[model samples]
Target chain A: DQQVKQNSPSLSVQEGRISILNCDYTNSMFDYFLWYKKYPAEGPTFLISISSIKDKNEDGRFTVFLNKSAKHLSLHIVPSQPGDSAVYFCAALPRKTGNQFYFGTGTSLTVIP
Target chain B: DAGITQSPRHKVTETGTPVTLRCHQTENHRYMYWYRQDPGHGLRLIHYSYGVKDTDKGEVSDGYSVSRSKTEDFLLTLESATSSQTSVYFCAISESTTGNTIYFGEGSWLTVV
Candidate 1:
C-alpha cells in the first residue's frame, strides 16, 4: 500500500502566480515532511521541509505547510517562475523508521511564461 | 553537490540477467538508501544502510539485495532483471545530525527488455 499519495498528477500555472502542490499521507507516525523538485534527466533536488512540530516552514519563494490533523501537506511557490517547472515529489519520514522516507507519486508542474 | 555519484547513469539489460548499480558518496554520511521511481509509484525504497555492515530492507525489498562493506559505498543488485523492473533508480545519503534530510544522486536509468 502507498503510504504517501499525490492526488493530482499535474498542474499548470502562470508565471508570477502562486502554485500549490498538495500531498496526503496515511501514516500518523510520520514526523518530517519534505518536497523535492526534479527536472528531466536529472536527480530530484531538495526544495523545502517541515517538521511535525511546526505547521509551516518557508524558504525564499517556497513554503511548506503541514496539517497533522488532516494528514495533509502542501507546497507553495510564490511568484512561480518558468524555471520551477518540473516534477514535484512529497516525502514523509516516520519517527520510528531511521531515515526511511515514503514518497508520493509526484506532480508535474508547468510554469508557463 | 552532495558528493554522491551513481554509476552507469543509463543501462539496458536483457530479462533474467543480473544487474548491479553502485552508489558512492564522499560526504561520509551514516545513512544510504536505494529507491526506484516508476510512473505511478513515485519513489519506493528498496534498501538502506545505517552503518558499514548494517543494512535493512525497505518496502519493496523483494528481488533486490544490497551491500555496504564500506561507509562510502552502497551497492544494489537485481538478481534477475525483468521488464517490470524498468525504471529510474536513485541513491540518497543523509546524516543523523541533519535531521535525516537525504540528498539524492543524479539517477540511474535501467531498461530491462
Candidate 2:
C-alpha cells in the first residue's frame, strides 16, 4: 500500500511563474516531511523539509507548507527556472520509525523557458 | 557533497545471476538506506542499516538482501536477477544531527536480462 500519494503525475509551467506540487499521506504518525528534486539518470537530492511543528518553511525560491490535520503538504517554487525542470518527490517520516521514509509516486515538473 | 559513492554505477546481468551493489560513505552517518526507482513508482525502500552488523528490511525487500559489516560500507545483493528487478538504485545516508535530511548518492543502474 502506498502511504503517500501525489495525485498529479505531471505539471507544466511557464518560466518565472509559480509551480505548486501537492502531496498527501494517509499515515497520521508521520511527523516530518521532505521534498526531493531528481534529474534524469541522477539520484534524488534534498530540496526542503518541514517539521510537523511548523506550518511552513522557505529557502530562497522554494517554500514548503505542511498541514498536519489534513495530512497534506505542498511545495511551491517561485520564479521557476528551466533548470528546475525535473521530477519532484515528497517523502514522509513516521514519528516512531527510525529513519524509514515513505515516498510518493512523484510529480514531473516542466519549467518551460 | 555528503561523500557517498556507489560501485558498478552501471551493470548488466543475466537472469538467475547474483549481483551486488556497494555503497560507501565517508560521513559515518548512523542511517543508511537502499532505494529502487522505477517508472511511476518513484522510490521504494529495499533495506536499511542503522549500525554495523545491524540491518532491517523495508517495504519491498523480497528477493533482496543487505549487509553492513562496517560503518562505511553497505552492500545490497540480489539473490537471483530477474527482468522485473532492472531499475536504478540509490543509496542514502542520514544522521540524527541533521534532523531528517537524507543525502543520496549518484545512483546505480542495473539491468537484468
Model 1 steric clash pairs: none
Per-residue alpha-carbon lDDT of candidate 2 for residues A1-113, written as tens digits (9 for 90 to 100):
99999999999999999999999999998889999999998888999999999999999999999988888999999989999999999999888668798899999999999
Local distance difference test scores for all models: 0.94, 0.94
lDDT of 1 by residue, B1-113 (tens): 89999998999999999999999999999999999998878999999999999999998899999999999999999999989889999999989833467899999999999
Best prediction by TM-score: 2
Local error of candidate 2 at A10, Å?
A: 0.7
Error of 2 at A57 (Å): 0.6
Candidate 1, superposed: residue stretches over 4 Å from native: none
TM-score of 2: 0.98
* Model 2 stretches with alpha carbons more than 4 Å out: none
Can you give the TM-score per candidate against the true fold?
Answer: 0.97, 0.98
